[model samples]
Target: MSLFERFEKSFMPNYGTPPVALARGEGSAVWDVDGKRYLDFIGGIAVSSLGHAHPALVEAVSRQVATLAHTSNLFVHEPEILLAEKLLGLLKDPAKIFLANSGTEANEAAYKLALKYGRREGRRYFVAAENGFHGRTIGALSLTGKKAIRDQFGPFPVEVRFVPYGDAEALREEVTGECVAVFLEPTQGEAGVVPPPDGYFQAVREICDSTGALMVADEIQSAIGRTGHWFAHQADGVVPDILTLAKGLGGGLPIGACVGFGEAGTLFAKGDHGSTFGGNPVSCAAALAVLDNVDLEHVQKVAAQLRTGLEAIEHPLLKGVRGRGLWLAAVLTSDVSAAVQKAAADAGFLLNALQPDAVRLAPPLVVTDSEVQSFVDAFPKILTEATP
Candidate 1:
């Protein structure tokens, strides 16, 4: 019986019992309450782009908090403006950004953008992909097609249609001119890190264009250099009318944003949408630190190397590996993902069970080749130990 026991007694059961209680983190590693060190591969679910306790992030947050910690939405902040410009600069198209506190908030804003833009006539429906995870907020959750998350949170907004992932024909058949938006994850992260079929996004873009439906890409988990690109959709050369970002955007801080490009950007007028803590100076500072450190070229090179090393791991149980850059899914032969996660934790490595048969590895952008080599060396044994 300890702090963990007390936590278990008091906390809600939504997340069940978290396996490890991390006390401190530096670079790509962390230590638990029991003083056990671990090489973090999940990067706080791809939130720590510059890794925990990065000096720049720490200094930026510190300076900003000391200067101006909280500002009401009434006043403008320089950091917020700078962050918006930086984020929009990352996109090829001119865009307007709406900041928020998390991924769901970003998606929420995107949903609002769609509705606002579609309200021009009678268009109001949103078409999303089945098994896609947007966010848990009322509006964002409405667009999320996964029944597991949406089942109990019923009585959601109407006019949402879910099509099978990567099925362009299905999307074209389901979404019509009356649909205001088409929402999808560039690569489905929560659904076992499923990558869409080649040329699939192009088809989606075509459908949205043909029907006047705005294409919305939920890059909450796939963007911010996680998949060897500023945004995953860039790799496919397909652009979306709206893009949502969070997770790694603010480095370790909490900040999310919905970016609307070209005509979509003009849909939201002043006073149309707002958030108090969305563009806080401290969070914007942290995000700037992340952007400064994460050079796209360097990340791309490192990601290619990491992928090569992971694929080189010769294990029979490792059925296959997918995804780009540090965002990867090591598919296992069986449904021992829980066991694998436990064993990896015990062995001083951190991983995630995105699905029963998929192990997600999204290490920090700063993770080195040496660390990837170490994980590759240890992976086979860990797989064996986790296997029943």
Candidate 2:
């Protein structure tokens, strides 16, 4: 509470008051300021890929910082080059990478590419999905579809038409010749872990192919083994022309990437766009360690166990679960997700109330089976406490 008081006095009101002031963490648990421990299922909103203070990430970051930290894009660094190569190799495609410090920055870079692509083709429009989230920055927010966060920030710099998500025909109607790109999240993270309809990405690929528009998949929340695949779009076997990644990519360090395939890869010329700490060697090394340590098979196994347990719970407050892999939402029968989140925290677990009715659970990729089972065992009581 003292730390939160200091935070209130020193900080702005953008995030309001943080409920927990964490002191330290290990594996899948965190200790609050008063020395209470809680299972950290939120995982810094899907950024801590290997859980807190993982040895591999710590060792890599330590080793890199003692060597070289920053090159500022004026000179090249080996770690950045190696990280980019590893990403491309994972995709098994030849592409270009622009490293940044956060998800929004990556989207901003991608936004520049879309603008440049439009300049070449004389296209003036972009298409995005309704109820989708890209990021909070203006360029990224321009492509965002949530009216609550976006309404006051516009008039957006870009012209974007938003169609109902998962409605491929509606998307087809929006992406005409004037459209330069179509941006979509394979799984909507902020709109409560909502996955698109079956065959949605395939339809998106077909639409972009037919219209010569670029396909940009914003996989910021669903990438880097979160979905039991290197990228969530791979579940559908669809390839995007441009993709943005962040969250888990840096293993809790700040690193984001904007990747472009084919023409989209070579769109940027001199003075087009750049960042100083975009490819910080320390961050790149941390990301590389994450790539080296993340287990996709483990992600698949635990995700199945967690999902099956969640689905088996019999409670009136439970409406079912939404999403795939570790990114999941417990759909409530009533709008009490916030209450449930509070209750869960009190019961030594952290959960996110993504919306009024959807409580999000995005645990670390390395979360153990016992941790998941413990959460499952405690969830029903937490729900009961919050509901009645």
**Candidate 2, 1-388: lDDT as tens digits:** 4888999999999999978899999999999988999999999999999999999999999999999988898998899999999999998877899999999999999999999999899999899999999999999999999999999999988799999999999999888888999999999999889998899999999999999999999999999999899999888888899999999999899999999998899999988999999999999999999999999999999999999999999999999998989989999999999899999999999999999999999999999999999999999999999985
Superposed Cα RMSD, model 1: 1.2
- Write candidate 1's Cα lDDT for 1-388 as tens digits: 8877988899998888888999999999999988999999999999999888989999999999999998978889999999988887888688888889999999999998889888885896889989999988889889888898897988887678899999999998988879999999999989888899999999999998998899999999999999989999999899899999999998888999999989998898888899988888899989988988897776787788777877887887788899878888989999988888988988889999889998999999998878877888888889999988
RMSD of each: 1.2, 0.8
Candidate 1 lDDT trough over 10 residues, lowest sum: 295-304
Worst 10 residues of 2 by lDDT: 1-10
List ranges where model 1 is wrong by over 4 Å.
none
The TM-score of candidate 2 is 0.99
Q: lDDT of each prediction vs. the true structure? A: 0.89, 0.94
